[model samples]
Target: MTLRNSDFDEIRVWDNENFVHPWEGMEHIGQNERTFTETADGIYVTTEAGKRLIDGPAGMWCVQIGYGNGEIADAMATQARDMAYFSPFNNANSVPARLAHEIAKRTPGDLNHVFFTTGGSTAVDTAIRFVHFRNNILGRPEKKIVISRQKAYHGSTFLAASVSGKERDKGWLDQAQGMSYFLPNVNPYIRPEGMSLQAFLDEKVADLENAILEIGADKVAAFIAEPILASGGVIVPPKGYHKRCLDICRKYDVLYISDEVVTGWGRLGHWFASEDVFDIVPDIITTAKGLTSGYVPMGACIISDALIDSVSGEKSQGATFSNGYTYSGHPVSAIAALKNIEIFEREGILEHVREVSPLFQERLTALGDFPIVGDTRGMGLVGCVECVVDSNSEDSLDLDKTVGARIDHHCQELGLILRPIINMCVFSPPLIINVSQINQMFDIMEKGIKLTTEDLAVKGLWSA
Candidate 1:
């Protein structure tokens, strides 16, 4: 095959043995991909194919600050030149230590103790081990099982994948776990015709309480949930729902862990969504993505004073903590993350989100009138426009690419980027996006929806 150097031919996805496309499937390995063709900067990727597409999703919702920030590059450069390689163990890098201190100062609660990792999966893994270890040290070794909501994504680690439901996007991992599952709170707006938000929360919380009584309170270690379901379609929660969830966790004396990997760092109009909107705090906060603004690989597991106190001065809880990554607080990544945090502060990314959030949401909410739009909902930048088998029916559209993929592809053709979140296509553009850009995104996105519906109708996939 005398192959010409086309777009994908130049895609620089460094495929080591461990590389797996995070949210994509194996069957989609090489189909209609703009993998590396989209490269230029500042909002749109000036593709080799000559498309100037607006980055509606902010490169997987991690590029908090806009692209091409020389300040961030310079920060990495300065750190590398000063001290490139050093660990945070014993006597190691001062960069991570300083970064930790700064993060502690910025994070909501006394979530003061920071443990670093290479990415979200590692951050989640660390939280899993830490929860087990903390329980054992606190003399509740029986409390080893974890409780998590359905459709929540923690990470790809063994325990995290196990914590998620049986059927999901990927079918790669087969880890063993004897964990308990609870009925998740259904999104208020998207609830079925007969269902009400209050009723849903009441039933779901009651289920958790009953589950606790059955499993024994002392047997459960922690309750993990993303503040808002990002991957499972940007499902925005109802009012006072999180507070009740928190109250239930406290009632059971179970440690609450917020998986802020998606919602943190201005994604939710605040630094940490746990503190910003919900006014709820958790014992541990697992995070990544925006931490380094996707510049360098980094994640962090932040813990409260109480949990840290439980593990303090206790080798009796099985010698050392028996966890940590080789790249835990890698100097370059730590440097990048540290600089990225500074960028967030210096640029006031959250303020930008606050200023434009109302306008951003108003346009999305207007999409609710669309014939195929089951729901257009979310907080801050993260939002979902669910397509149903019937806009007025309870059944969802075929989870296959039918409607969602058509919309995503249509958006790509219209010079906009989006992801098909289950039956919904999601948009969580960079917090740096202006009001004008927000308007442009929804305008293009609506066009994509119309095109998708028309295409599906031609294929007879349209809901009656």
Candidate 2:
């Protein structure tokens, strides 16, 4: 089973020829270059070419407990041996049921009911569908408009993608645009030059309230928000922004859905960040990624008891919710999630995250020392470093696009892998990482940014 360097060459040819990747460009269908990961342990992944790099993005912000956890693998194997497949539609399984109970106890407020999905996209899709179903059952079919914020990333399913407001990701794809309304981007870094922080916060809150008022409260179903917009360069909104938005939603009778795919499972030093970090209990909370710590694929749309209560009972006997995936609540995935939670508790992973996050944030914010670094922001374990070529120049937009990739190239060479989003490089290393590793990661990152800055200056694309 050991793959040699030549084996990877063959694999790369096969990958380029047949395997389509996420966000694949049409021109690069058969010509794409990519790193082939051969194995992983702790916080590092070893490539097929024998390069070991810190998994900076933590396997797309999952892998909370880190790679190669024998415990998790053993749990998965045991679950598969007991029972692997079942129709959750009609039959119920104990694994997912137990996992559901485990999640319900951790989730804030009355979000006590859990519906399983294959991943984050389906989790969000289920949440949206549930909103529609709840509205329909309550005799308010017109209440179907889901409000989302610009730069927010929900997922890739039709319903999820439709509600996601990342402008760059929507250029070539079609989405159910009419089903959603988008609020303005809430990145505090992008606030108007002379505006005070309080003023900006007020304006951001007003955007939501105004959107609900303009759309009419009766038509607005929910306001879905990521506590920290993960994919949007780790944009942290103003303080009290989420709480105020929750109040607005409550005033307008709009449901609040906290999209916690990246924030949940100890990323924010809590099982759920909505109530713990932001002090807002959402009506629905969609989570995945760290749900199984990337050991297996799974996601969940947790429902408030109030919403479930309105639809259940003899009054609505035959009216079914009628939306789910065949692989919903897969036994192996559920067991994996259960084991992931167990590890989180047994190892006090949440406490570890809380202890080390201050250091993580401190080092992350220090990236702003670089001349080309436009902004650096994050909370808990996730962070983003944004680069700018020349904000005032006409060619800045075009030049900026390559900045992240250049930084990533240098970082990978220096034994770090970053998830570059246009001109931004994001970091969400394994929650299991220690302080020394944190220093090492940021040290390499700083060097990478310096190298990239030098490269930009040499090419005459940037000066500063």
Candidate 3:
């Protein structure tokens, strides 16, 4: 489907004039024409210019089942035709009710109650609100501080952004100050020199304890973390880190919120990584993205019965939670999520991810042999390749050169799309990608990195 030059020109002009892209340099982006994605199928996205590139970031770490899934599309259509929108505020809908039941059944521990939202940000925002609400109901209004680790990307909402630790993201943005605390991210690759993995884990846990003590546990509300930090360069913490953190949260009476926005669904070879992969049952689990496979905008904050029980019962006299979204349980989105989960079960996507993840990790780790490759780290199907000017000296990549962006440029030309996060190139392809596809992805990545290294060496920025 080749578009006419006039059609392309009109789209580019309209997009540049009207569309406000997220986390982008608007002026720079407007000056340089945007590459519009016309269509997508399987793992490949066809641009408006008709160039098909493999989607390496899985449509912002969402599209778990891949693209052009007719069944999901049909599900949305059927629901839309039947009943598209309905308020889930006080009123109940069948699809949302059933979907909530299905989600609750799959979630860990007694996280049996589902509160639906528009997307990951709202899901996180809702969870934080619930924490505040719970504490308020329990007469502990001072316990309102939410602790999050540095470099963690929660969401873009006011409360969610406040909890997020990405410094660059919060530059000009105003967050709810004093409402959130920061902890050091558990990046084992950059852990202090000579510290054993166990010691590093202990130090991270101790830092949380110290933060709680310093802030006074009575004033702390909840602690939120990702099982595997996805947007923060795919930083996978040391073994048993989550368990220790959960224990600390429990000891400090802080509600533990597992932000599985990127790690949920089949990304980590499980329905939810908090229990299956990390072995920790958090008080609240916030999920989005793969929940509906990016088919529709949806997210859910699953709360444990224990927390609900604490705030409920005869203690509160006729009190309501008093919060919800208009599209909280939109039938179309609910049906899409339902069919998405059905496809996961019928196709055994989790088993497939587990089967292919080792090879995926191995191929990615092999890129470390490249001269500019500093470190390669990942778990499940999500991974990252960090580039440095000097691996031995640990010198940072030159921002002027934009090493990751250069690699992305090469990769895109070689039939792949890569997410360049500063010096790190992150990969979270669709879970439906097979072994051959994984190899193809890595082959293009290696070529890109090699090309970038050669360019750097020519400019005397690096050496082989």
Candidate 4:
């Protein structure tokens, strides 16, 4: 379907004048026009110009069940017409209550209590607040520090952003000072020159322990982390990293909060990666993005029964946990999530991901053969291809050239949209992507990388 030129013009004018995009500079926005996605279906999205492009990042690492799921849309419509807006603050709602029970059944261990939030950021923020509230109830007000790993992307809210260790995201903003601390990221590709993977893992785990010790166990509230650092270039840690981290947190009496905003809901061939993939049950697991498959805005912080029980005692004076959003459990969003989970179970999306992920990883790993490709790392469906000037050297690509962006530009023209982060291009396509679609995506990526390499060579920036 073609939109009229006037329609496109009106949209462009309104967007340029009214829309304030995230993580974008106003100068850049004023200078360049944005590509408006008019429609999406399956694993692809069509732009206003009618160009179809593979959504390589799965719509910001969501959309696990893929796009254009009519069932989900119909569910939302039905719920909206039935009862759209309802307050979940000390009030019972059918859809949220039912969805919470369903979520509890799937989440690992005693993580049976679900606290709904607007999205991942709010979920993360709420989880931290709960930790603080729990500690306060236990008469340990000093235990307010949250230890987060470097390169971890928690969320955009004040507390969540404070917990996030991505320095660039915090440069211009003011974070909640002294509320969170950072540990070095576990990027296997950038581990010490001669250190073995086991040694690197040991050091990382030791760092967590050391940090907890330095902060005083009584002062540390929790440790939050992503199973695989998603937005931070898909940095997959060494084996047994998360399990060891959880052990350290438990030993230190620090609540373990798994930030599975990007890894949850079949992204990693499991409902939740903290237990199914990492073999550890965190005290709190924050999830969003894929919960409703991005059909609607929703997120949830699943709390362990142990934690909830501990904070439910009558020994201390009664205190109310007054933290909640107006739309904490919006009926429409709850119904959307319910339908999303239904699709997952009915279509066996997790099994499909498990079946296809090996091929996806294999295809992504093959890109490492390129001279500019420094590392290929990821698990399940999410992956990243890191580019460097010299594959054998430790030096990174020149920032001015924006090698990843160049590759992404070429890939976009070749029918694929990529998430370019510095020198790395990340891919987390919808779980429903087939082998043929996987091939098509990588083929376009390879061609884009080659074209980028040629452009670099022509500019005297690189050589094979």
Top candidate when judged by TM-score against the true structure:
2
Q: Give the TM-score comparing model 1 with the true structure, all chains together.
A: 0.91
lDDT of each: 0.77, 0.93, 0.91, 0.90
The regions of model 1 sitting more than 4 angstroms off are: 1-20, 27-34, 170-172, 314-318, 390-400
Residue by residue across 85-105, what tens digits does model 3's lDDT show?
Answer: 887765778999999999998
Residue range 348-448, candidate 1, lDDT tens digits: 88888888888888998998887878778888887888876544434444534467888888888888988776577887887788878888899998899
Give the higher-lDDT candidate: 1 or 2. 2
Q: What is the C-alpha RMSD of each candidate to the true structure, in Å?
A: 3.4, 1.0, 1.8, 1.9
Instruction: State, as a TM-score between 0 and 1, how close model 3 is to the true structure.
Output: 0.97
Name the candidate, 3 or 4, with the larger lDDT value.
3
- Model 2 stretches astray by more than 4 angstroms: none
Ranked candidates (lDDT, high to low): 2, 3, 4, 1
- For residues 240-267, write the lDDT of model 4, one tens digit per residue: 9999999888887999999999999999
Q: Write the per-residue lDDT of candidate 2 for residues 1-464, one digit (tens) a residue.
A: 99889887778889999999998888769897799888999999999889999999999899999999999999899989989999998899999999999999999989999999999999999999999988888889999999999999999889999999999899988999579999898998888899999999999999999999999999999999999999988999988999999999999999999999999999999999999999999999999999999988999999999989888896465699899899999999999999999999999999999999999999999999888887999999999998878777787767777888889999999999999888999999999999999999999999999999899889988778
Give the winner by lDDT: 2
lDDT for residue 332 in candidate 2, whole number 0-100? 97
Candidate 2, residue 64: the lDDT equals 98
